[model samples]
Target: MNEPSTIEKGGAEFEGVKLLLCENPLPPIDETIEAASDELPRSNHYTEPYSAPLRDLLGDRIGVSTEHIHINAGSELIRFA
Candidate 1:
């Protein structure tokens, strides 16, 4: 926990800013981003079973294999066991 620091709300900073611990912005780095508008497979089908390439990349990022990862759609309902 952080000691509540009072913010001056008069001169340059009219809006009082509250510092949070859970979030912090690091300096931006060079990275590749794929846009949805990019041309891709036209096959109107679900990536059945799983998408190996996506899983592979994800696993590599977190230092794990695809077998150790699980995926879920945001729209799909999940039940807590």
Candidate 2:
């Protein structure tokens, strides 16, 4: 069953908040937004299918086959396979 709905609080949240209490300093919001804006044009195309290269890099670091790797599309998609 779901942990009693924190939907009552409203807005975007990381599911990891349930598991990890972090106090790490986040980067400046304006710099982050500017960096994202630099990649805005690429959003016009379907790029999810293009993530294999990233998975390959991750697999190399972890010493696993790329075919065995998976990347969640977003925090909302995080779950056991």
Candidate 3:
């Protein structure tokens, strides 16, 4: 009998684009620094699962429902991919 195949899908079947990571070229602004400092106290806690506030803002600007918004941290995206 033939052995079962371990490979699930071939490379040609990949339908997603590859994303690359790079260091930020710009320095943080005063507002960015202030926000980071403010959040430092809550650094130990995990961020909201869906980042509702940011999603809400984006949804309003784009005329889409919050349910259509999907947010992911840069590190999480890289790790998962």
Q: How many residue pairs clash in each candidate?
A: 0, 0, 0
What TM-score does each of the candidates earn? 0.35, 0.38, 0.47
Candidate achieving higher lDDT, 2 or 3? 3
RMSD of each: 9.0, 10.4, 12.5
Give one digit per residue, the lDDT tens place, for model 1 in 19-64: 5797555643434223333435544655544567878889999999
A best-first ranking of the candidates according to their lDDT comes to 3, 2, 1
- Candidate 3 is scored at a TM of 0.47
Q: Worst ten-residue run, lDDT, model 2?
A: 12-21
* Ten contiguous residues with the weakest lDDT in model 1: 30-39
lDDT scores in order: 0.58, 0.69, 0.71
Better by lDDT, candidate 2 or 1? 2
Tens digits of per-residue lDDT for model 3 on 1-81? 534433334634333333347655568899999999999988997667668899999999999999877876545643332
Off by over 4 Å in 3: 1-21, 72-81
**1 versus 3: better TM-score goes to:** 3
Best by lDDT: 3
